[model samples]
Target: MPLSVDRLKTLLQDDIKDLTKLSEILNKERTALKERSNTAIQTLASEKSTCIKSIEYRAKEKAKMFVDAGYQIKKGEFEKAIAEIQDPSLQALWRKVNIGLRFCQDQNTINGKVVSHSLKRVNKLMDIVRGQHNKPNLYGSSGKENSFGGLNSIAKA
Candidate 1:
C-alpha cells in the first residue's frame, strides 16, 4: 500500500520543525563556544542531541514510508523518492527539510572547527607548561643545549 500524502506531509512538517530547532541550537552552541561557556555549551549539546534524535526518527519513518510504498531509498536519494511521488506539496516540504538540514550541517562543521582550534591551542599551552616542545633542543649562547626542568619537574622537586 502506498503511503498517504497526508502522512508524508506530517512527517516532513515535523522534520522542518526539528531542523529549525536544531539550527537554532547549533547557532547557540557556536556562541557558547565563542564565549567558552561550558554550562551553556553542555545544555545546548543535550538539546541538540534530543533534536537530532527526533530528526533521525522522522527520517527513518520517512524511509519506512518509502519502503512500504515499494520504493528503494538510497543515500542522498530521499529527494528523488519525493520527486517520484509526484506530489508538489511533498516535494516542496522535502526541499525545505533538505535546505534546513544542509544549514544545520554547515553550522555543525563550523562548531567542529572552532572546537578543533581551541583544543589545539590548549594542547600547545599544556606542552609549553610541561616543557614538552617537539622542537629540537637549540644551543644556548654558552654553547650548551638549553635544558631546564619543566614546571612539573620543579613542582615534584
Candidate 2:
C-alpha cells in the first residue's frame, strides 16, 4: 500500500534532520583539520625563519674573519695571520652550518607540502558535503528560481 502524505513527510523530515546532523559533524571535522594544518604551516614558517637567521649570522661571522685576514694580507702579514688562525675549524663550521640550513629548508618544504595537500583534501570534502546538503533531493525544490519568480511578480506592478 502507498504511504500517507503525513507519514512520507515525517520520513523526509527525519532524513533531513539526520543529514543536517551529519553535515554539521563533517563541518566540525573539517574545521579541526584546517586548524591542524594552519598550526603545521606556522611551525614550518617559524622553523624556516630561525634557520635563515642562524645561517645569516654564521655567514656574517665568517665574512668578518675573512675581512680581518684580508687586511693582514694587504699589510704583508699574511703568514702571521695564517699561522695564528685555524682554517680547518672555520671550514668545518661553514660546512656544518650549510648542511644544517639545507636540512631545515628541506624539512620546511616537506611540512608545507603535506599541510597544503591535507588542506586541499579537507576543502574538497567540505565542498562535497555542502553540495550534498544543497541538492534538491535532500533539501526540496525551493531554490533561486522560486526567489526569482517572486521578484519578477513584484516587478510587474
Candidate 3:
C-alpha cells in the first residue's frame, strides 16, 4: 500500500533532522581544523620573524666591526666577518635562521593547500544540506521534475 501524506511528511521531517545534525557536525569539524591551521601558521610566522631578527643583528654586528676597525668595508670583509665569527652559539643561530626560513615557506604552502581543500569540502557539504532543505514538493504539479535542476537552483539561491 502507498504511504499516506502524513506518514511521508513525518519521514521527510526525520530525514531533515538527520541532515541538519550531520551538517552541524561537519561545520564543527571544519571550524576545529581551521583553528588548528591558523595556530600552525601563527607559530611558523613567529619563528620566521625571530630568525629574521637574528640574521639582521648578525649583519649589523659585522657592519659595526668594519666601521670600528678603520677599514673601508668591502663585500668580502662582510663575508669574512660572518665566516670568522667563531662562537658556536652564533653559528647555531645562523643555521637555525636558514632552517626556519625554509620551514616557514614549506609550511605556508602546505597549509594553504589544506585550507583550500577544506573550504571546498565544506562548500560541497553545505550545498548538499541546502538542496535537501530547499527541495520542491515531489508530488506537486509545479514541482521541478529534475532533481539536479533543484540542486542547481538551491546553489544559485
Top candidate, metric TM-score: 1
- Candidate 3's displacement at residue 107, Å, is 2.3
lDDT, residue 70, model 3: 49
What is the lDDT for 73 in model 2? 25
**Mind giving the per-residue lDDT tens digits that candidate 1 earns over 41-67?**
999999999999999998888888888
- TM-score winner between candidates 1 and 3: 1
- Candidate 2 lDDT tens digits, 1-157: 2213343233334433434443343344345445775565455445545544544554454345546445332443433443345455433433444454455445445555666788667766996878844323233275422212223254453
**Candidate 2, pairs of clashing residues:** none
Per-model TM-score versus the true fold: 0.82, 0.39, 0.33
RMSD of each: 9.2, 28.2, 26.6
Q: Among all windows of ten consecutive residues in candidate 1, which has the lowest summed lDDT?
A: 148-157
lDDT of 1: 0.87
Q: Candidate 3's residue-wise lDDT over 54-153, tens digit each?
A: 5455446545555665445775653354356554544454454445445544655655677787776786699797785544434346663423334434
Task: Go through the candidates in order and give each one's C-alpha lDDT.
Answer: 0.87, 0.45, 0.50
Q: Is candidate 2 or candidate 3 better by lDDT?
A: 3
TM-score of model number 1: 0.82
Model 3 / residue 153 / CA error / Å: 24
Backbone clash total for model 1 is 0
